[model samples]
Target: MSNTGSASFLRELNPNRVEATKREALLENPGFGRVFTDHMVTIRYSEGRGWYDAKVVAHGPFSFDPATLVLHYAQEIFEGMKAYRLPDGGAALFRPDANARRFRNSAERLAMPALPEPLFVDSVRELVRVDREWIPRTDGSALYLRPFMIATEAVLGMKPSPDYLYCVVATPVGSYFKGGASAVTLWVSENFTRAAPGGTGDAKCGGNYAASLAAQAEAIREGCDQVVFLDAVERRWVEELGGMNVFFVFADGSIQTPPLTGTILPGITRASLITLARDLGLTVREEPYAIDQWQADAQRGKLVEAFACGTAAVVTPIGKVKGRTHEFTIGDGNLGLVTARLKSALLDIQNGRAPDHYGWLDRLF
Candidate 1:
């Protein structure tokens, strides 16, 4: 399976597919990642063979051996992106090349084989093409794509596995956060940290999310919608949410976000927002923001709006923040002007409502 080069995937379509009626019923309210398409893309990788045996096959479970390396050592990586529905019933992918580059970077960080970026993009394109019908017809609805790689060698070792299995699966999704465009409350975790300076925090891997479940549960217990982690070193600087990057909007029309200083996952949506913000002639700064400062500014009306961004969540406004003994609400405790404007701009480009000046859409149909 070690070919490291671009290879066309063989087609093995699903025969016992779901009828359009049932699929349509499911798509009507596919909350998120619940209803999947019929087929998935899979590619095999070996130590010396690189990547091979690429194909689109029926979506189902794999019989994992008891001694699978991924089960033991947890050497795995993944990427998340979406194929949006176009005006003419076509579908377009947003910044797939960026997702591909990030996938390669995540694989390298996990000590796994570097899957060729072209192959990664191709796998996603092929999967969406095969499951185009799975894409929702609504403007904001989409077919969420998950491309992942895991060490498949059946060995009881602590080193990197020689065999890997790469697969791409599609799910019809509406909104990531149930709150939708409404502002969300965040619970600051004083007891836990998400990522450190020299950690896998920047990589799109399962381990990071696995480590965040406890804090997320704690947030839910504290009556919050999401968990925001602080810097691992001093625990004073704001890092990011469990799965999204955050941005702060000031009353002076300036925007700031925690810098990508090797501790935060560089989100594709985050980058796009920065570009769009700059295009709007608003000053954008990548700097460290402390929790105390956030509360103080919000209380004094210096900070007007804040939002979290990611491939899944897109741009979600942050209205309230709650820590151990402190809580403050952003401007009016509602969706701020800047937040709504940016979200509309981003969704417009994604759903083909506005001109894609940045050339971000990769048309799939």
Candidate 2:
């Protein structure tokens, strides 16, 4: 067998496990990204040695030098996925292979070495297995897994690191929205642009998210839940929110989303919902949507619903939109039928409450 085989990786476990009582208590109210599981997975990569030292160890802080390459040049990438406690009390992952592939893409874009897909998936699987007890049992809740890679080389140059660390840590999370599943209002950010052509917007890197924080803070200060950014070139086309992809449902029963044109992040949730919508017999369109057209359509009742989708939020309805000069409400500013139906369908499949006709779930236990 290969040295880095799944069995070898599994045998390297040294779990500093969390106490059952404390873990259970945290699971009871595990807010998003706050509480973590007992164990984490780590693998090291070097220019000559390749990937080595794979292990599942206790979750804790890492020793980082002040001049670490990632801190200076930001050579890092990450993927967000979840492990669900099924209705039958088993554990499963939702399209982890997809995440593995995307992680490779992000690594390539950021000038980082791509960890083998099998290794990536196996690392996540073993960590989730060791931390299975941390999976939250609350409804609309799961163990949110974050797999990230960072350049660990202690250099302050403008080049990629020669050494890297890939790690996976999981946190049991409750509903992403604090109070409940209510519609949200969005603030259009005409002043800031998320990404331009031939940029890192499509890559799932920390820099892109860091660039969006100022705009997101602006939205929060302006009495909005999220900020919607436009395309960088024209500044008129609707792109996406800070961390999620936007979808619009028209009055004619057609669903539209901004195309993945190297400027917007290709969201896994957005892609899944597109397939699910088509399977439900709804027309799915991938085209550029303009901010002004969104305002006009919502005002004229042509746009029935608008929602954002991501790994964290899943499907969130956009009720009210506020721009500098234009403002409108979509479909009575409530959760539209299409939005609710799509959300329920995706969640059902994810939680294993519905039949796995599409074979999306990877049964881990």
Candidate 3:
């Protein structure tokens, strides 16, 4: 719903494309964000002119000045979504309009110009169409698309850039984590908070991720796969994982997650899972969950299952939790019935293995 007028994209094919044989070999075992497609989409925005000069060109890098605003001030935001290989031998995207709406929200929060929703979807459509051959048909594999915006103006002052670049690049991805769907252990961070009220924590920005790396490193040192953050004010409530939203399953067939209060990212996948869980007639609650209460519930068998959801990782079961002075395992430290049911329901519709009753799939030839 942005005011930027319609953009007419110009296509420019890649002069040096990988041969089909090599491309096939790459797609066979293409891990997450490692192997990219041949082409990409780029659109520019100026303070006065709005969005302009849209193009689909060969995949490559850009040469920017050292004073580039994004490099110095970290004015950037990005979204991750996927294109699925359908059962009928076609490609489709899941919930792109939702991504577009979130993208605009991120732009506004970062003091950047908004791109029209139609242009955003059209740009993705163009790039995916140009590189449709790269869509992988393997289980849990698809073309992962990264749409991002960066402040491009060269300056030294601390302010929003006049020039910005919006681009979409895709990679053939099989799994986000090396463990695949196997359960992951989380290290609870009492020292670091992900976002505070009136902060960029709710926005999908580069700074927010950069802020989590230190806590993530600490987790890895503790032999954990990921880091989970607590609320900034209290440091008692569980907010979210470093990059994904978390949900807890109880024995009564109820689901609960940390609410969105301008401090947690409102994940599209998390929203979808909430809907699908409720569709099964289960009660899903969006409320504050304390870390100590979580461990207590898990120990007493009140919490049966817990999982994290996002675009790249999909729905990942969280098995164990570790902190400075406490450690506990959830639901026998294995995938539970509720987690599996929700995951299957989401992935089945995504991969076209089952009927899409919600009309979530936007199929492409």
Cα TM-score per model? 0.98, 0.97, 0.98
Order of models, best lDDT first: 3, 1, 2
Q: Which residue pairs show collisions in model 3?
A: none
Candidate 3 error regions (>4 Å): 1-6
Candidate 2 local distance difference test against the native: 0.90
* Candidates, ranked, TM-score: 1, 3, 2
In model 1, where is the ten-residue run with the lowest total lDDT? 1-10
Over 70-184, each residue of candidate 1 has an lDDT whose tens digit, in order, gives: 9988899999999999888888999999999999899989999888888888889999998888889975688899999999989898999999999999999988988678889
> What lDDT score belongs to each candidate, Candidate 1 first?
0.91, 0.90, 0.92
Of 1 and 2, the candidate ahead on TM-score is: 1
The worst-scoring run of ten residues by lDDT in candidate 3 lies at 1-10
Steric collisions counted per model? 8, 0, 0
